[model samples]
Target: GDDMAILAALGLQSYRFSIEWARIEPEDGVFSQAALDHYQRCIDACLSRGLAPVLTYHHFTLPLWLARQGGMTSPEFPDRFARFCEHATRHLRGFDIACTINELNLPLFIREPLMARMTSEKALARIAAAEAVLHGSINSFFLYSPREVILNQGLAAHAKGRDAIKSVRSEIQVGVTFAVQDEQAEPGAEALRDQRREDFYGVCLDAVKGDDFIGVQTYSRVVSKRDGSSGPEEGHPRTVMGYEDRPQALAATCRFVWERTATPIIVTENGWAGDDDRRRAAFVPEALSELHDAIAEGVDVRGYFYWSLLDNYEWAAGYGPKFGLIGVDRATQQRRIKPSAVLLGDIARANALGADNRSAAAPQVMGDGAPVGL
Candidate 1:
């Protein structure tokens, strides 16, 4: 239903969208030719209009086969996933820009939704009661709340993402990408250190430990530490949902990665979710400023892509979080550019003029922690 004409109108040169696995391959190895044809048309349409297609092979969802076959936990997952990547990359060869994986961290939750899904009747009763409080208005941001808690068993997710990259490296200009909420450990709190917030983050980066490029997805920041305290306790003051106005922290994180890795980095996803145009505009500039500082300080930062071409389904949050430059009416799929989207268009134009030219340097933080063997 999406012609993506709004993006062309907004003057965006490149945009990233995922090839929904479920849509393409509803069954195991039984892909729909119609889906392939539709996708081909989509790709050709983008190229025809001078828009770069950064095709994502997988987002959070997967073919029911994979989910049925033990999902990522299956021993056969690596081989099957690699084969899938090989086929996808070969099929979409010569796309303008390319991404191998979507939000890598997100798969962590999708593979295990039960961690958050409440089964008790009492809980269901409470949810019904809570909805009654809204007086028929949908709590659009429901999934983002703590109740929908999906834990990332960091190492497992990282391994899957890494496997995806290695699978297609020989066939495509592939990169590893993940959605990251810039979580910070609360300063002066030993518990923050104990909770291993940094460890969890490091795992995401580790997924692409030795890749051609790394895609960093920035949405909000959440300072998550295991809260064992009784009530209303604060350990490390990480950003509330990963957006704590901490440009310095963002810069430091990038700098840390720069100091360590040899891979070129891309800001694959960075945006604010709000109704305020001014704040949203400020958000992009600030994140870019931090990125600029990281590059200047010797990070091989390559390109920056905003979180979306347009606001669509916010996953469990539905249509609530407006992380798009072109706002979407979920009901109508009509698109209009927010001021921030305009700012991005200007930046994209400038960058296209400049091209992706950068220098190479050895990482400064390459081995802060001893390397782990995969």
Candidate 2:
């Protein structure tokens, strides 16, 4: 496919995409020179095309070594993941931009039924056994939601990761991306739900507060609670996921976050998924419009990177949800540019041109603004 060419065609200034950890480091502790070179080439290509590469150190993918180490939830995991982050940043020090972690707030652990069942059962048994062996030890406590554990561990690792990157290349700009959902305030529910959303910001803010940028992945509204009397609503607006579809609420949440944090924000992944292109485009425009409003209201919103350049495996759902601007033919890996892709390309071109013109016309400065020729 024309992955690199497509980026150039889009005239993109900045593009955010994840490098599957498994793809890069398939075997534990073993570095693949070929893969490393390939990524180096990819980064070079982005720079060649004038597109800043926003590298995601970890998405949902994990290395086998880390996976065997009980993934992110393992107590030993924070150190292990820190080492991995140190290693990754060491290798990717010269990238255009770095997002140390992606979607750290997503409820990926409990959402996947099979994995959740296995994780809960396995973790409980392990914790129970540990508690028995270390009955008096203070570190014997157990917690559910390995993903949550991962968040705690990953944030620490992210800090180490940042230091590691700067040690090698001090010029690289690094940050973190959180999957933030805007929640709607329920009727008669007071503003408690709003507080919960604000608390969610703590997770993101805590992770990237010291970083150069904040990548916020926003999608449908976050439903705080569903009315139980809705009579078995499975699909449509009344569905459980409907509470997460509040666009205005999401915008407000963004505004709140921007007000609280001085860091520049980037909409790393904010787009809709639909069966057809038209619906997808409509949703994207709406989201972008909300983002624009947020920016206009002084949100310090910087760049926008659509969730995905292409559809990939969505964990348990695999390839079920098509959220890509470019439709991927899974069988052959061929990509078809959807209408949203075209629209994004146009938007990028316009923004880049606008930025260029603004810069070119700005008056030159000389020695504390004194006359240059005098």
Candidate 3:
């Protein structure tokens, strides 16, 4: 397939892609061998091209049947997910690395009611409209209460899923991913920022402590003040997602997660979202340079997978945010590789950072260079 060929051309040694639960099991207690066979072809294609496939069992989409049954908050959710993982792993046995879930902490922040309450009226209206278009009705969104329930269920699902996969193939590596925001505090807000980090990520990071590795997905920097104000600063360059253009966030996030969990890290998702290929071209080298600095400093960082290989649908945002190294025409399904893809490909082929691409100044050190105690 074109995807495998392109990955091989770029000299990438690994490819990470997700399997849709809905596609594989459209109804409760029903399984489709055709879907399994289809994904098998994808796995075989990657192998033929000499690329190791890193498969993710879930990536934020629930089968309508599962959603109707209370999704993640359901007590049965973990067992159901583990059953699905057990089925999927039978087909994916040879692959050495598998992610049990993507962004386990995402549900806490993205629930409809929370967004409706926390965001501007205009932003809330846009989200409601997008939900209608994506799900056919705004009322269809899952609304779970007591945020702790969502976190607890996610942790349970991840633990069960990891165990299920390891049961099938004991040698396989299994872990869950987290979305880490590199939060900086204003002079009077250090404790507040620390508390926010604990509230958002601490539990999930603790859950994955004994797993194979943790997937750190970070893209920008957020500055928090004691008054609970937090967002990109006004003057910084922003990505299409409205995140500040802080390439060094990669290093800061790596160090932060390393200090907390002491688990091996894999950057499962990191990239800028924009239509300007030129900006992406420039952004990648800078981000990778920061990543290289993290590696040189004794963080057991394993690999980095760009956020995406193609511009595709982005949940409620739809196709508006472009985070791909390749562009696609929705009408004709045509593909065009962007300049940034080539830039990244060159770096992969060389297997070393280019001298010209080094950061002009020393990269920022995370956490005052102090030993972090969990």
Per-candidate TM-scores read 0.72, 0.76, 0.88
lDDT of each: 0.54, 0.58, 0.77
lDDT tens digits, residue span 269-372, model 2: 66554456776666655655666666666677656666566765556566776667777887888878787777766555554222323222111110000000
RMSD of each: 9.1, 9.2, 6.3
Any runs in candidate 2 off by more than 4 Å, and if so which?
23-28, 108-151, 225-250, 352-374
Tens-digit lDDT track of model 1 for 118-206: 45787567667755653442222223323222223223434454465555555445676755544454455456643443444455565
Instruction: Specify the poorest-scoring 10-residue window by lDDT in model 3.
Output: 365-374
lDDT of 2: 0.58
Clash totals for all candidate models:
11, 8, 0
Residue-level lDDT of model 3, residues 214-257, one tens digit each, is: 98888899888767788887798999888998988988999999
| TM-score computed on alpha carbons, candidate 2 | 0.76
- lDDT: which candidate is best? 3
Instruction: Check candidate 3 and list the clashing pairs.
Output: none
- Which 10-residue window in model 2 sums to the lowest lDDT? 365-374
